[model samples]
Each structure stands twice: as C-alpha cells, then as structure tokens.
Target chain A: DAGVTQSPTHLIKTRGQQVTLRCSPKSGHDTVSWYQQALGQGPQFIFQYYEEEERQRGNFPDRFSGHQFPNYSSELNVNALLLGDSALYLCASKINGGYEQYFGPGTRLTVT
Target chain B: AQSVAQPEDQVNVAEGNPLTVKCTYSVSGNPYLFWYVQYPNRGLQFLLKYITGDNLVKGSYGFEAEFNKSQTSFHLKKPSALVSDSALYFCAVPRAGSYQLTFGKGTKLSVIP
Candidate 1:
C-alpha cells in the first residue's frame, strides 16, 4: 500500500508571506498530525486533526493552522512567516485508536 | 505528561560491533515508547515501540529495544552495527491524555568503519 504522501517537496517564501503545504495520509489512517523539525533538532508536535477538527495543538502561535478534508487529506498553513519558521514540515498518520503513526517524506519550508 | 531523555548527544561505534542507544522515560503508569531514525534531510522512520507485551520489542532494520520498568529505560540495541546504520535516533513518548508525541533531543549514532 502507498504510504503517507506530502506535496511540494521543497518551498521558499519571504518573510510576512503565507504558504500552504499538503499531506495525504496512509491508505487506512484517519488521524493526521503535523510536526516541525528544525535544524539539528528532533521533531516537535504542531497539532493533530481528526474528524475535520483540530483535536490537540502544541505551543505554536496562531499563525500556524491546518485543515483536514473528508478524504483524510490535510493541509498546513503558516501566515506571517519568519526566518525561524524555516524547517522540515512532517506529516504523520495513524488509525483512530492505533499507537503507531506512519510518516510522509515531509515538505521542506524555508523562510528567507 | 510523560517525558523521555536521550543522555548522549552522540554515539560512535565500530562496524561489526554491537551497538546500544540509550533512552530513559519518566511516567506515572505504563509507558508507551517509540524509536525513530532519521537520515539526512529525511523524515523519521519508525523503528520499534514498547507497549505492554514482552520486554523485548523488535522493529525494523535489525533493531530491537529492551524495556525496563524499574529503570524506566527503553534502550535501542543491535547485534552488529553497519555503516548504513549511522543516523539520528530519537526516542519518543505520548503526552498524557493525548496522542501527541514528545520526542527526545535525539542521539546521533555513527557506525564508523
């Protein structure tokens, strides 16, 4: 089966600009979660989406938001981007009650 | 909430030698732990996890982890190291009452030839 997939392998945006990244979860997963991996650091939770609603969010600012469509595909939106926002955006998905989360290749976002 | 720690910033081992990447956790009850490896510029690849079954959990790429309840540790181990095994390894656990994973700072494993 095809694993999780993400769009726009790489992106570059200027400060104060907005960008959107897309993700398609694994074949049978229903819950989608987003993570940010900065240089030389581990992945940090951004937020999680289930049933088209954001269930849990990390310490990110309001500038970061997301949406999950009925088909289980999701989109991550970041507004007023800053240089610090430059990082690898990772998308992971799992079954509603499963513990293991499969990840996508991720979208690299660079705020210049 | 549960938190995990990877005390070592970097671990270097010779190829063909056994390797160990340490991880310790802090939690009140049963701990669900996971291990993931990230190659350069790539997303994490799941290795193994410890739930409530046997203490030894085997995962992908000839990797295994031993869960110790008394020590509160879940260490990743391999019988013999390989050059391709060099990567950044992270230990993670779910936050209390949620599915969000709290990842350790990560341990960089370098299997030198």
Candidate 2:
C-alpha cells in the first residue's frame, strides 16, 4: 500500500507571503496531524485534525492552520510567514482514533 | 506538561558492539513511549513503542527499547551495532490517552566499522 504522500517537496517563498502545503494520508488512515521540524531538531506538533475538525493544537501561533478533507487528505496553510517559518512540514496519519501515526516524506519550505 | 529528554547529543559505537541511547520523560499520567530513526534527508521512521504490556519492546531493524516506570526512562538498545545503523534517533512520549507526543532533541548514533 502507498504510504503518506506530500506535495511540493521543496519551495521557496519571500517573507510576508502565504503558502499552502498539501498532504495525502496513508491508505486506510483517517486522522491527520501536522508537525514542523527545524534543522537539527526533532519534530514539533502543530495541530491535529479528526472528523474534519481540529481536535488538538500545539503552542503555535494562529498563523498556522490546517484542514482535513473528507478523503483524509490535508492542507497546511501559513500566512504572513517569517523567515523562522522556514522548516520541514510533515504530515502524519493514523487509523480512526488509533495512536500510531505513519509520517510522510514532508514538504521542505524555505522562507527567504 | 509532558516532555522527553535525550541526555546525549551523540553516541559512538564500534561495529558488533552493544549500544545504548538514553532517554527520560516527564508526564503527569501514564506515558506512551516511542523511538524513531531518521536518515539524512528523510522523515522520522518508527522504531518501536511501549504503550502497555511488556516493558521491553522489540521493533524494526533489530532494535529494542526498555521502559522503566520507576525511573521514567526508555532507553533504546541494540546488541550488535552495524555501521549502517548510524543515524539520528528520537525519543518521544505521549500523555495517557493522548496522541500528541513530546519529542527529545534527538541523538546522533555513529557506528564505526
């Protein structure tokens, strides 16, 4: 089975610009979560989406938002991006209510 | 607040030697523990987890982790290290009933041939 997939493997955007990153959950998974990994650091939770609604969120600013579609795909949107927003965006998915999350390759966003 | 700490930033081991990467956690309730590995330019790959039951959990690539509730530690171990096992390892913990995980900074394992 195909695993989780993300779009736009790499991108470069200017500061203050907005960007959208997409993700397709692994086959048979329903819950989607997003994470940010800075260089040389572990991944940090951004937020989680279940049942098409955001269920839990981390300490991230309101600039980071996400949506989970009916087909279990997801999109992460960042507005007014700062240079610090540059990082690898990862999408993880698990079976309905199950805890083990399978991660995608991630989208590398570089804010210049 | 739940958190994880990987005490060592880097670990070196000779091929065929036993290796260990240490981790400790802090959480209010029972914690679910996990270990993941990441190669250069790759996403984190699940290694093993300790949710319930056995304290010693074996996972992919001949890796195992021992969970000690008394110490609130979960250390990953490999009996015979291989050069190919060199990579970055992360330790994470989730609060009871929560899927949101708190991750340690990560440990870089270098196995010399």
Candidate 3:
C-alpha cells in the first residue's frame, strides 16, 4: 500500500510570487491536513480538508488556502509569498475517524 | 484552546539506557495526545497516540508513553535506547472537535553508542 505522497521535493520562489504544493493521501485515507515547519521549529497546522471542504484552519493568513479533490488528493496554495514563507510544507492523511495520521516526505518551499 | 510543551530542547542517553522525553499539555476538554519522530530533512513520523483507555500506550519501535491526567503530561519512554533512535521527537494535541494538531517545539534525542 502506498503512503502519503507529496510533489516537488524542493522549490524556490521570489517575493510576491505564488506556489502550489500537491499531496496524495495515503491509501484508504480520506482526511488531509497541511502543516508548515519553519527552521528549528515544530510544524504548525495550516488547515484540514474533508469531503472537499475545509473543516478547520489554523492562525494563518488568507494568503494560504487549500483544496481537496474527490480522490482525497489535496493541494496547498500560497500567494504573495514572503521570505518568512520559506519552510517545509508537510502533508498528512488519516481515516475520517482515526487518531493516527500518516505523513508524507514534505515539500521544501524556499522563498528567496 | 489546546497546546503541548516539550520542556527539553535535547536529551542525551547512552545506548542500552532507558530514555525519557518529557511532554506536558494544556487543553479545555479531554486531551488527544500524540508522539511523532522525525529524522533529518524528513517529515514527522507517527509514534503513538493516547485518546482513551489505558494510560500507558505502547507504540512502534518499542516506544511507549504514560498519560498522567493529574499532571497533564504524556512523556515518551523506551526501555532501551538505540542509536538509530537519535532524532527529533514531537508531542502534539488536537483541539476539541478538530483535526488540526498543535505540535510542541520538538525535542531532539541523542543516543551515544
């Protein structure tokens, strides 16, 4: 069985640019969540998607948004990126009612 | 609001020694606690979770955690440390009725051979 997978192992962007990160949920999983891990810090929740709708969001700006497709794959979009936006973006997936989540390798976003 | 705290930034233990990584949490309702480990340049890997039932929960890699309601703490412990276990450990909690996991600043474990 395939685990959670993410695209673009690494990325580089300039200020005011936009970037999109993709994630494929683990097999037999339905819920997808996104997190941002800055240098030397634990991951901070970005948002979660279930049933193609955003269920819960963290204390992030409007510039951060996400979408979940029917197949349970998800995408994270960040607009007007700033240097601070540079971090590792991780994708995790779990069953609708399950407590344990499986994580992807993550996409490294470097805003230059 | 819910939060987790990993008091120590790093822990050092010799091989074959018992290892402990401390964690404390704050939540409005019953806590859903979790532990994850991350290696260099990798995403967080699920270690274990404490939702309900037994206070002592066993998980992968011979790791376990004890949930103490009185102290609001869940510390990860392993009977014998392995050099491969040297990595970053994170404690997390989910808010009531939410899937968002609030992670504590990770604690790095170093096991010397």
Candidate 4:
C-alpha cells in the first residue's frame, strides 16, 4: 500500500498569507497527524485527527488548524504565516492506538 | 507532558565502525519510544519502536535500540555503520495517555568511507 501522500511537494508564500496543505493517509489507516520540521531539527507535533475530528494538539498557535475528511484524508491550514513557519510539513498515518506511524515525503513551505 | 532529548547535534564515524545515537525521554507514565531516520529532503521514516518487553529492539537497515527504563533512555545503535546510514536521526516518545509524540531536536550522522 502507498504510504501517506502530501500535496504540493513545495510551496512559497509571503508573510501574512494563508496556505493549506493536504495529506492522504496510508490505506486502512484511520488516524492522521501533522508535524513541522525546521531545518536541522526533528519534527514538532502540530495536531492529530481521527474520525473527522481533531483528537489532540501540540503547542502550536491557533493560526494553525487542521481537518480530517470522512475518507481519512487530512489538511493542515496555517494563517498569518511568519518566516519561522518556513519548514517541512509532514503527515503521518497510523491506526487508532497504534504506536508505529508511516510518514509522507512532506511539503516544504518557504515564507518569503 | 512528554519530551525527548537527543544530546548530540552530529555524530561522525568511519564506515564499518559501530555507531550510537543517544536519546533520553521524560513522561508521566510508561512511555512508547521510537526512532526515525530522515534522508535529505525527505520526511521522517520509522526505524523502530519500543512498546514493552525486550529492551533490545532491532529494526530496518540493521539498526537497533535498547530501552533502559531506569535511565529513561532509548539509544539507537548500529553494529556496523555504512555511508548510506548518514542522515538525520530523531528520537520520539508517545505519551502514555495521549496520541501525540514529542520529538527531540535530531542528530545528524555522517559516516565517512
């Protein structure tokens, strides 16, 4: 089965602009989580979605939000972007309560 | 709150040499630990996980990690390093009562031939 897939392998936006990133979880996976990875850093948790609702979230600001579709696909929305938001956005998929997670290639966002 | 720590920013070793990437974690209850590798321009890849039992966990690409509860550590190791193993390594911990995973800053491994 294909692993998690993310749209717009790369993106560029200006400060204060809004952007939406998409993700399709691996087949048979019901949970989706998003992370942001800055250069030279491990990924930081953004949020997690399960059953079309956000299950948990991290320390990210309210400017960051997400949605999960009935089909288990997910989208991450970031508004009022800042230069610090420029990083690799990753999508991870797994079954509910499962510990192992599969990841996508990620969307590299650059705020100019 | 759960958190992970990768002490080394970068680890350097020659090919065929053993390599170890140190990691420590803190959580309220039993923790689920994991190791992931990221190649240039790619997202994190799951290398292995420690749920319970068996402190020594082996994973893909001949990688292994030992879970030490007393020390609150889960360090990744490779019996023999390879040039291909040179990449970014991440240590993650899944909170016992939550689904979120707290990650470390990451360690860049460079293996010279």
Candidate 5:
C-alpha cells in the first residue's frame, strides 16, 4: 500500500551542472511519468517509461532523459542545467492502461 | 493539438460556501479529461477523471465535475468550501494517440475562514 516515493528531496546545482532525481513507483504500479513544475505554474510533461523502455516523451529537449528499472523505479537526469531548470520534478505511476496516476512528493531542483 | 485552459489564476471563497473552479479543454473525439490538485511544495494528486458516460463525475473529497460537451468544458465543483481545501488545481487532457498529457496553467483556490 505504499505510495510513490522520490529521493533527493531537495537539490542545488550551478548552471551547466548535472542533476539526477529518483522515484519509486507505488507498489504494483508499472508505468512511470515525469513532469517539471515551475513556481506558480502547472506541471509540464517530461517523459514516460514502461517496461524499462521510454514509451513517450514531451517537447522537452534531449538534455532531459529518464530510465525505468525493472523494479518499476525510475530516474530523471538533466544535463547542462540552466536556471530555468529549477523547479519541482514530479514522478507519477499507475497500472498499465489505467487512467488514474498517483504521484510522489517530488524533488525540488534549484539551479543557481 | 490537445489543450486545457483554466481561465482563473486565483479564486477566493468564504468558508462553508460553495465554490467552482472553471476548466476548459479542446481535443478531438471523446476527450479523456482529469483533475489534479497540488498542495504547497508537493506533487500533483489525482482528483478525478472523465473518460466516458455520466457527464457528472464524482471524485475524492466531496468534489465533483460537470462535463459540458457543447462548450468543451469540465468545471470542478464542491458544495462546501473547506479551509483545508485551499490549494492549486489543474485540469489535464491526454494527447490523442500519445501517452503524455496537456495540463492547464492551474487555478489557486483560497478559502477564507
């Protein structure tokens, strides 16, 4: 009955640096999606992973990437981070083909 | 392109009063819409969704939404406002044939006690 969990609750990085965020899907959930939420704005889709392969991605550039482990956990990696990359990174999971997704607390990334 | 719009940037309501947060979406064919809420410094939580049947859908926390086909809108409603209910709400619609979702900018609800 565990909900989605994320690691590195808070992060600080300088411009051009790299950062990685981690997430563990809810128990029994198989699909994981990533999103970036800027202050005072809704989340923007990043990419999604299923069956250890990326299934779909948003309009974000290649600098943003992700991976899903066989255990249903996932990681979001950002390279050459910019100040605009500072935001809350959220990870959500749901059963395959399920419409409802449960989310984690999210990792806050701060780029200076 | 699929899109969702929350016309209101912020909404204020008196405690115990009913409240409505408007959301509108444009997409092809039958739309699969969803409502999500986010608290301060937290991730978005699923509130409800409308896939098919019953234009009026009830969701968690005594919240419900009405789907208006003619207007291409889905408005979130709650009979009574709670101070605890004050949070950011987002309306989202998945891209057709795509696994990603398009979300509204979000509406911030503030309930005055």
Candidate 6:
C-alpha cells in the first residue's frame, strides 16, 4: 500500500508571489491536514480538510488556504508569500475517525 | 485549547545507555497524546500515542512512552539508545473537537557512540 505522497520536493518563490503544493493521502484515508515547520521549530498546524470542506484550522493568516479533492488528495496554497513563509510544508492523512496520521515527505518552500 | 511542552532543548546520551525525553501537556477532558520523530530534511514520523487504557504505550523502533495523569506528563523512553536514534523529537496533542495536532517545540536527541 502506498503511503502519503507530496509533489515538487522543493520550490523557490519570491515575496508577493503565490505557490501551490500538492499531496496524495495514504490509501484508505479520507482526512488531510497541512502543517508548516519552520527552521529549528516543530510543525504548526495550518488546516484540515474532510469531506471536501475545511473541518478545522489553526492560527494561520488568511493567506494560507487548502482544498481536498474527492479522491482525498489535497493542495495547499499560499498567496503573497513572504520570506517568513519559507519552510517545510508537510501533509498528513488519517482515517475519518482515526487518531494516528501518516505523513508525507513534505515540500520545502523557499521564499527568496 | 490543548497544548504540549517539551522542556528540553536537546538531550545527549551514550549509545547503549537508557534515554528519556520529557514532555508535558494540557488539555480539557481526556488527553490524547502522541510522539513523533523527524530526521534531518524529513517529515515527522509517528512514534506512539496515548489515547486511553494503558499508560505505557510501546511504539516503533523499540521506543515507548509513559503517560502520567497526575503529573500531566508523557515522556518518551528507550531501554538502550543507538547512534541512529539521534533526531528531533516532538510531543503533540489533539485540539478539542478536532484531530489537528498541536505540537510542542521539538527536542533534539543525540545518541553518541
């Protein structure tokens, strides 16, 4: 069985530009969540998607948004990116009612 | 709001020695805690979780954690450390009414051979 997978292992963007990262959740999983891990810090939750709708969100600003497709894949879009937005973007997926989540390799976003 | 705290910034131990990484959490009602490990340039990997029932939860790579309700602590432990065990360790808890995990600042563990 395939685990969670993410696209574009790395990216480089400039301030005010937008970037979209993709993720394919693990097989048999339905819920997808996004997180941002800044240098020397733990990951901070961005948001979660369930049933193609946002189920929960963290303290992130409106510039960060996400979507979940019917196949349980997800996309994280960051608009007007800033240097501070440069970080590792991780995707985690779990069953609708499960507690454990499987994570992907993550996309490294570099805002230069 | 649920939260987690990993007090130590870094921990170092000799290979083959027992090791412990401390963690504490705060949550309303019952607490669902978890441990995850992250290698350099890699994503976090689930280690173990304490949902309910047993306070001692065993997980992958011979790692285990003890959940203390009175102390509100969940410290990760290993019988004998290995050089390959060196990585960043994170403690987390689920937000109320949501599965989104709130993570603590990670602790870096270095097992020296």
Candidate 4 docking classification: high
List DockQ for all candidates. 0.76, 0.74, 0.78, 0.82, 0.76, 0.81
In terms of lDDT, the poorest run of 10 residues in model 3 chain B is: B94-103
All candidates: TM-score: 0.98, 0.96, 0.97, 0.96, 0.98, 0.98
The C-alpha stretches of model 1 lying farther than 4 A from their native spots are none
- The deviation in Å at residue A97 for candidate 1 is 1.3
User: Model 5, stretches more than 4 Å misplaced?
Assistant: none
Q: Compared with the true structure, what per-residue lDDT tens digits does model 4 show for residues A10-108?
A: 999999999999999999999999999888777888999999999898889999999999999999999999999999999999999888889999999
lDDT tens digits by residue: candidate 1, B41-91: 778899998888999999999999999998999999999999999999999
Q: lDDT of each structure? A: 0.95, 0.92, 0.95, 0.93, 0.93, 0.95
Model 1 Cα lDDT, one tens digit per residue, A1-112: 9999999999999999999999999998999999999988889999999999999999999999999999999999999999999999999999997779998999999999
lDDT of predicted model 2? 0.92
lDDT tens string, model 6, B34-103?
9999998888899999989999999999999999999999999999999999999999998888878889
Query: Candidate 2 — which pairs collide?
Result: none
Best model per DockQ: 4
Ranking by DockQ: 4, 6, 3, 5, 1, 2
In model 2 chain B, the worst 10-residue window by lDDT is B94-103
Among residues 3 or more apart in sequence or in different chains, the pairs in candidate 4 whose N, CA or C atoms overlap within 3 Å are: none
What is candidate 6's local distance difference test score? 0.95
What is the Å distance of residue A23 in model 6 from its true position? 0.1
- Report the lDDT tens digits of candidate 2 across residue range A1-112: 9999999999999999999999999898999999999988999999999899999998899999999999989999999999999999989999866668888989999999
What lDDT tens digits, residue by residue, belong to model 3 across residues A3-110?
999999999999999999999999999999999999889999899999999988989999999999999999999999999999999999999977788999999999
**What tens digits encode model 5's per-residue C-alpha lDDT throughout B1-113?**
99999999999999999999999999988899999999888888889999999999999999999999999999999999999999999999998887577889999999999
The DockQ of predicted model 3 stands at 0.78
Q: Residue-wise lDDT of candidate 6 within A1-112, one digit each (tens)? A: 9999999999999999999999999999999999999998889999999999998888999999999999989999999999999999999999998889999989999999
Spell out the clash pairs found in candidate 6. Answer: none
Interface RMSD of 4: 0.9
How do the residues B39-111 of candidate 2 rate in per-residue lDDT, one tens digit apiece?
8877778999998898999999999999999999999999999999999999988745678777899999999
